[model samples]
Target: MNKAPIVFLIGFMGSGKTHLAKHVSGILTGKVIEMDSEIEKKYGAKIKDIFSEKGESYFRELEREVLYEIIATNIHSTAPVLISTGGGTPCFYDNMEVMSGAGTTLYLRPSNIVLLRRLEKEKEERPLIRNKTRDEILEYIKQKVNEREKYYLKADIVFNPVNPDIGNLAQLVKEIIYSSFPYFG
Candidate 1:
């Protein structure tokens, strides 16, 4: 088995990191490690509960720890690992640097309008935007993305205005990675 770098997907909440990771996993020999799902499974508590009970600081600590553990495992594994991080993961705690060092980071940057539309539908499940009104969500996305762009831009590759077609994206990503590292047969 070829020891490929982990593929870390980062973006805003509604930017489709998880969805894209699933698509990419089909082409790569990687299992998906979705941060939020892992956290929920491990703690047996929803993220919103974790936030309300333990606070964001504690949640961030958990995120950092889980990320490090995943990276360590990836270091010893032959197969690639596709890690879909939470929307805020890259923006805090040297996460972007660590992920980039351990693997390939991809920023899925959909338009803010697209994010708003998607997020508005999933607001109830999203802790950060759950209580926000439509107008608030629009403004929130704009401000947060502006704040986080510096970190997101540090990724090895960025897919802006990502094509809505999952198959096309998976193929494109596969081609890019294989061409970049010609040793992969």
Candidate 2:
């Protein structure tokens, strides 16, 4: 029997893709394929280290490969996993094309101020963003968000990071999936 297609969560840093992906995965009986974690495993280092040592250009190559692999691997995977990608995944390379082609792409949006706060707390863990100041981070987010919005807008669904409420975020995910495409259930 043919399995359902995969789902993708595309957004900026601190936009909450990982958190939401986990929720939807549970509700959908799908696995969560985290692109960043896959890269770290291949290189045997943290994502921050990959950026620091190999640089963004190199990391992008790995990102593309992982995205491709995830889709190919899950083409026959029942339950269909949710993919949480890095902030820049859509901006660079052909990742956006691959993601949108693979399955549904959802955008998880939070306010810019909220993102600033979230990024501030974890900049160290995200080396590409560690050197940016508050204003710079905000500006960068604005610029990147603007650029990626075109791709993200192609998603099958969009949700506010706060509206569904984090506590029930998982439930919301399932509800969205079931309601939007009940046949998948």
- In the range 69-181, model 1's lDDT, one tens digit per residue, is 88887775555567899999998999999988887888999999899989999998887888999999999999999999999999988888545788888777777655544
- Model 1 TM-score, 2 decimals: 0.91
Clash pairs for candidate 1:
none
Per-model TM against the reference:
0.91, 0.88
In candidate 2, stretches whose alpha carbon ends up further than 4 angstroms from where it belongs are 1-3, 179-184
List candidate 1 stretches off by more than 4 Å.
Answer: 1-4, 180-182
Scanning candidate 1 in windows of ten residues, the lowest lDDT window is: 176-185
Candidate with the greatest lDDT versus the true structure: 1
